[model samples]
Target chain A: MKYSGWNILKQALTGKKEWAPVWHKPEPKSHYETIVIGGGGHGLATAYYLTTEYGMKNIAVLEKSHLGSGNVGRNTTIIRSNYLLPGNEPFYELSMKLWENLEQTLNYNAMVSQRGVVNLFHSDAQRDSFVRRGNAMCIAGADAVLLDERGIRNLCPFLDYENSRFPIKGGLLQPRGGTVRHDAVAWGYARGSDSLGVDIIENCEVTGFIIKEGRCVGVETARGNISANKIAVCVAGSSGRLMGKAGIRLPIESHVLQAFVSEGLKPILPNVITFGAGHFYISQSDKGGLVFGGDIDGYNTYAQRGNLPIVEDVCAAGVAIMPMIGRSRLLRMWGGLVDMSMDGSPFIDKTRIEGLYFNGGWCYGGFKATPASGFCYAHLLAKDEPHPVAAEFRLDRFKRGHMIDEKGAGAQPNLH
Target chain B: MIINHPLLGPRDASEFIYLGDASLIDRPDWNSENAAQQFYEYLYLRDNPAGTIRELWFHEYGDRSWLVVTRNTLTHEIVNVELARDIDREEKHSR
Candidate 1:
């Protein structure tokens, strides 16, 4: 039952009962060629690419909870490739390219709106840094534009320009960056993979890994024991705990990051805008609610909730830039657990145990890196080699003194 | 969240700056034979448990004392607080 305009019209003209479920609830098999843990966006995307790109078969995705129950559905839905480091710029640019063709590729509506993303800079030094970052983006074949104060004002006139503390300066604009329907991405990939004969088993929690000698032979789950030649762990916040079951500690810490949405109003923000002096970033959703978030709670926690101080701090930062948002009635807020790595950058690499792979430590930026993370993880599983764009994202980078500390926050997961 | 500071009784958690895992207090000897591996583990690896854990917090806005705060990561409940200097001295005596 391929989704198409003709099919939709035919179903509409008929009794509208011809529609099928988005994905099948398939029971887990005893064995599979590869087992992908965590049925979040990355896991599903990895399975999707493994089947579609590598022509692989007998793949199963195991989820502890239902699909889109993790950060994939919890993110602010913004996507961009405005990175500053060489190790990251090209990979995110590849993700940006993938997002451009995602809907057509999956035959599902993902609502990838590239309205643009503007990273605001409040001072002279910040402007210079943004310029350097824009140059880095351009060098990586990603679109970037350095917009002056006038340009930012033209895009968002409601910004506080005359504030005595941190006045508006300029911003680095990426015209090809914006928001996507977050949950739809998971559904699209899930459906696309399931339609291609991949089993997606939900509510099956992986309790441990079965290691035969030095190789990972299978996984012990709450449902039962399942075997696979290769097992890939893509649980974002649960990376540390999941891998810990195999007696392998990770260079990752789980932190709670909260996101907020205000009462629906008329459209005000044209694109994603990030505050320079603070960790605040905001964009208006299609429903006219302002979707925004700030820094993580700055502690190690698996709890998917935050305290009041961060909420107040994020709200203050929001008011510092766009004062009008202060008047908007607060609607709802929620937290998502994020895997903050030592060097801040993510890892898409294999582990010491043969045939066991790991993909996590996305910090707070995993949502934007979903496509590339999946594509690269699939490439690794299929070819047993890192993708060229993700070659630097090795598990032993820290041990080899090759830390990709993008924010220069050394060995501190919370700061990153 | 409130941190029951060892020195100052019951203070807002915001007054303190959180540094991760209290195990960081046990710095490995650099001159050991397995210095490289030990340093790697010290810098990268983490228990990151979902249950009760001890972590370091600096009283930045209040006193200049460093405290080892034992808190449950799952519930964010502070169980105990002690001066890091006291803990360091106790460990030294044990050694």
Candidate 2:
């Protein structure tokens, strides 16, 4: 049990460039019961379900690079279920529930911290909206508490309370919302699925779909064509192209999100704090480094490099909120590709193509939803039916006018 | 709405696009949830204390980036928006 989810998280959260390839050779068996593309959280989780839940052992997870090299390996790791839409709400809630029991679910340590999250509100209008969202989460069985000025002051005492910019009117607090080790979530699933005998192929990129008679039979990878009964596409950052290859268009936009860490400091704050008016969120890592992240890149590109203007803006907000951190210097900053959808929520559903399934379009909440996404996706992959939580994320939503838009923003990458 | 270059400090009033009534200025606690709340109170409340100079102008409605100048009764005309950088600037006010 020591290899429990949290322990593995201890290693992954440090962001060490370690971790070597474990199992599986490059030999494609020409056929598998299920073939999952993209070895990130969603793909690995889908593979895990195909094996453990359905007892369907003929499965394989194909990654272009080594495992966890995608967004799964590069995220801010904030886990929360404060959604406003029905399609996204239940799934995120389920993901939050999964995070609660991740140690038992994966039998690995993921450093799941229930430090609580506070989404602040600036204006009365904002307050009302925040309250509505909080109430919905409360009804959905999440521990959400609505806070006012006094309430916010009690939680975060070191803020610049006098003549400030975005006044600390109040925040919506979900005690269950916290963070975890992102990389470990990937390795834990990879290990869990590996132990279950799923073939996880790394450094093997999918070249094209083996579409036979309008049905996907397998994928033609760089090594060669590997046939399979069912195929899953889970390439997050670069998923749009892969989906396009299958003759289907997904409402996914690829954008870059940047994250930074301040030099390690003693843990002064216990909960994760975010600025409502300005786009900024800060959390202290176990390494004592202050982890910070903000808004998506205004443009679309597969490039991993981030712009510096946003860095300056977010840093200014940080200083305005917590002047005490004026002495804190940003040690390093990195960017990751985001598969932002029309709505800010994620989508994981089967496509119109026969023998083909998809598990992509997780905007920013991929880390916390790893296990639950895997569990439900596993269920979806095994039974050929959408999990109860993932039923509404169909690709036809846009055409049908049934979009699950939590932010009321369309799938434009710049808006998100 | 138009806001001055030098961030208008709490209650320290200048020419601002007519949004609403005079807003009050309240002190912010070191630890508060939305940090932007302190300045926003200025929109609804004004702390126009009499016979004193407050060296502050606010860009509450940050719609456009413009180079505007501001002056106070107690002090001479100052603050050139030509170089309205986003950096935090400090000016000592003699009340």
Which of the numbered candidates is closest to the native, going by highest DockQ? Answer: 1
Q: Native-vs-model 2 lDDT? A: 0.71
TM-score of chain A of 2: 0.92
* lDDT of each residue in A60-118, candidate 2, tens digit only: 89999888998887888889988877777787898888788876777777889999998
Q: A287-371 in candidate 1: lDDT tens per residue?
A: 9999999999999998899999999999999999999998998799999999999999999999999999999999999988999
Each prediction's Cα RMSD?
A: 0.8, 15.6
* TM-score top scorer: 1
The regions of model 1 sitting more than 4 angstroms off are none
